[model samples]
Target chain A: MHELSIAIQIVEIVEEEAAKVEAESITRLELDIGLLSGVERDALEFAMEEAIRGSLLEKTQIVYNFIKAVMVCEECCNEFNTDDYFNSCPYCNSLKTIFIKGKELNIKSIEILKQ
Target chain B: MCGTCGCGEDEHITYRNPNNPDSHLHEHSHFHGDKEHSHAHHHEHDHSHPHSHDHSHDYLLKPGGGALNSQTIQLQRKILSKNDLLAERNRGHFEALNIVAFNLVSSPGSGKTAVLERTILEKGSDFNCYVIEGDQQTMNDAERIKSAGAPVIQINTGNGCHLDALMVNKAMKDLKLPENSTLFIENVGNLVCPALFDLGETKRVVIISVTEGEDKPAKYPTMFETAQLCLINKTDLLPYLDFDLEKFRQIATQVNHHIEFIEISAKTGEGFNQWYEWIVKHRLSETD
Candidate 1:
């Protein structure tokens, strides 16, 4: 659903970067996807391919790296990695938790072939 | 090959490396070493290169895609930053116009529409009311507001789970909104994806009705934490439902202490006056 819109944003960013670096073709796009980012990787990839057609980023490979969700328990102060979107702390069973990492949707890097 | 440094400048650039003859990696490396020194590398080849191949220049783009002057542009563009930039643009636009737009988010059947309906009925005449309604289908909510005599536009997401700023921008175009209008955007009935997107709204109003369960604030705390105001709607249904209004307030406050909570029922016209008063106060403060 939001993947198509997200894909459009991806295309816009890549196109802007291509223009900035004065590059004619984009070879690779690297993305860091967080576990709790709620973005479907396969769906996003498929959407990106369809969205990038007839654009400057045609025939580009999208390299996505998924990061596991991590959080710190407010009660026990224990930090743990979890794939669970919602779960109590394993140590204290307390719902008071602060998210440390994951939930990140960023373009980590891009490889453009210079003309 | 040059024997001293193993740099291939010799007469025979063989596909086989003189060292490690039995290793497969050596054979593969030798193949690439010859490939890099192919006729394309030489300026005198008279096919592609007009200038002599500079030893200093790094020829990263392999000449593969023919005749479009195909230069591959390598970049590290943050996908989220693009939206953030547009979001900032929208924030600036709102600030310049002195308009306060709020994105209302909640679960389905959370009394968001009722809150708006009651709000419009009470204070629609005082301020220019405009709404951007997001739903999977039907302009029913928009129709309701239009009959109430407020400027309303319904955005049928078709299957979209959230409303992005770009869609808000398009919806605003048709609104013909006033210079300093108070725009209320009722996001699609979703607690998750809608929390991630920013619609250039000054406030993010999260509605939590009593029937959905008290643990809603604890379970889906992101929208609660992110919102500026948390309206606990449908208070009239509190007695029949096993919903603890006090417990809900306690958990919601723990998640967001600074957020203002208004418990009201848009239906039956109970506790709506307080919401109306708050809106007027906010609008006055903003305009002042």
Candidate 2:
């Protein structure tokens, strides 16, 4: 699905960054995919396996950090982890909640090898 | 890489005008991070030109790893930044051209095209509208919009689930949209993927029919959250279906406080007046 596109984007961004540094190859790629980012991890991983082939990331170890969605309840002033945005607060059963995390889709870092 | 760029032919996104049916294939690989990605070609025209080129610098083609060094580069960059940057460029272009662009997003069969068709037909002699129809693979919507008396282009994203800003930019180029006009970009019929992609539209209108139920807002909160206007379509069918309109509004408002509601029926021409008013309000951008 869109994970394929996201994987392609990841590869493109990492490759571009590596190119600027004149890196020969990327040894590792660290990705931060929040649970609420709407991207499935398995889908992205599968896509990455195909996306990295014949590229600098061919031999690279890909690491995925699936961040959990953190929500802050406006009623109880308590913070909690949720799998989705619609989850009511566990502590207060309040629907008036603000999302603090788990929507992040970012490239945390990359281990590049230079020649 | 299609012999020159590192991209394959499958990565090409086609923009086709329904009236003409001639597609313009644009490569997405080159449009990723840089405007141009160039690497020295080492393969000969004849032989087994091994596709050994890794996505790295030119030196990787050579042998020695004796001078190879590895380092952990810390860059917490958003992966979609490339798309976002292009989206901003699109916004700038629309601003310069004085074109008010609206990104229409919804699920399949939610009457996005129907809304456009009715809007274009009913809003006659008022504003010039250009349309960009995005689907996985179909010219049906484009053809429908063209028949609705508006210049339309169809973007058939082969395997792409959602339309990105790059695709919209390319389509915009092909459309050659007139100044002081309206551009309706009907995004691929998906609530999940399209939520993350910013197409730089003046206003994002998310459409949902009564049959979709109230849970749609809660299920796809991101889509509802990001959108500024939520068009509740198929009000005519509400008499038959036990669709709770108040609960839907409640859930939608909870997800997006700033979102405005417009109950429209693209079929019976009911509530087209409010839709047109909303369009004019956004086209003028509330400055007036």
Candidate 3:
């Protein structure tokens, strides 16, 4: 699954950041994954567990902040939550809706303990 | 780490010849630092500098009262930023060479290689064409493209589902493509993961054969939505299959209103001219 690749990338990013701060160990990591980001949460967690073995984040507690997909209708200005891209606006039945805030896949923060 | 997977850092991508069982190995290490960190920061205050202390003023400070200060670093960085930056570098390279690169994506048996073969056969004399073929572990596509009379390179991605921008950048260096040429990057035959990666192609063409169901556009909207053109291949077999052309078009258009579609049969050359014309026109427009 692509989740393994993504998980590895997350670990790499965390390791790089932790090295910059000279952290003894990472205590926690928070990720912001959106509903429309095309990532499965459980799969990512499993992949991360596999990816972090013997790595700097081996003991880190991972936290996920899932963002819900919200679409804004261009025709009727209606805002709705949806996971599908082909969804139409509920109020106006228009397919001209755009995603306002659902595609985010980011590492929001990381807690590191200094030696 | 393997460029595709982060298992280990020393893994090198090996390019092997399809025809020869034991051809000379061409090993290329994944280029690190190709992607620039857009969010690099410099702290003004130095944490390593110890604060001034007075031993006589022990009354002012209590021993063992202060706790270790753990820091929470705010990154707010996009997960795919590295790939995006590398893709941008590839775009810059393409622009500098005036090359129009097309990313051909499709299912395993969707005739992407056939389309590229036919395109090269028909237009090879008029233009310089280069191909970069991607597959999990095969040089068959590269062999086919080479036989079609064009320079071709094969990238065996071992375990990667899709070709990232870094792979393309490496392939470009090996290709030595000429200026004002068309580079066709035949991505690994999968619609899902490739849609998430940007290969710095000027245009993305997704091919779907008539043998497949009309619900493919609805099922994999991300690939259809990301593509600029949808080449509906195997129109010659439409009479025998139960594929609904109208329904497919409707769903595809609903998913991506800006996408252009062309029905063609690379075998019989039916509606193939239109496909070539579309490419030439877009290439001209991009250059202009």
* Candidate with the greatest TM-score versus the true structure: 3
Tens digits of per-residue lDDT for model 3 on B1-288?
224542323133555444453553565564333322121111243233121222342332335554344789999988877778889899999998889999999999999999999999999756688898888876788889889998877887776678888878877887788789899999989988788788899999999999999999888887888899999999999989999999999898777778899999988999888998998997797688
Q: Which predicted model would earn the best DockQ?
A: 2
Error of 1 at A79 (Å): 9.3
Whichever of 2 and 3 has more DockQ, that candidate is 2
Residues A3-88 of candidate 1 have per-residue lDDT tens digits of: 55566667777777777877766766777888767566565665565567677776666677788889888789999887654566
Predict model 2's lDDT versus the native: 0.80
Residue-by-residue lDDT tens digits, candidate 3, A1-115: 5666677678888889899998776777889998777676666666666667768887677788889989898888999999788888999988777788777889999987674
**Which segments of candidate 3 are over 4 A away from where they belong?**
B1-12, B16-24, B28-67
Q: What is the lDDT of residue B20 in candidate 3?
A: 50
Error of 1 at B140 (Å): 1.5
| Residue-level error in angstroms, candidate 2, position B220 | 2.5
Sort all candidates by DockQ, best to worst: 2, 3, 1
TM-score of chain A of 3: 0.91
**Which should have the higher TM-score, number 1 or number 3?**
3
Two-chain DockQ for each candidate model: 0.16, 0.40, 0.33
Q: What is the DockQ (computed on Cα atoms) for candidate 3? A: 0.33
Write one digit per residue (lDDT tens) for candidate 2, span A1-115.
5666677778888888999999877877888999888776666666666667667787787888889989898889899888766677789877778788998999999988776
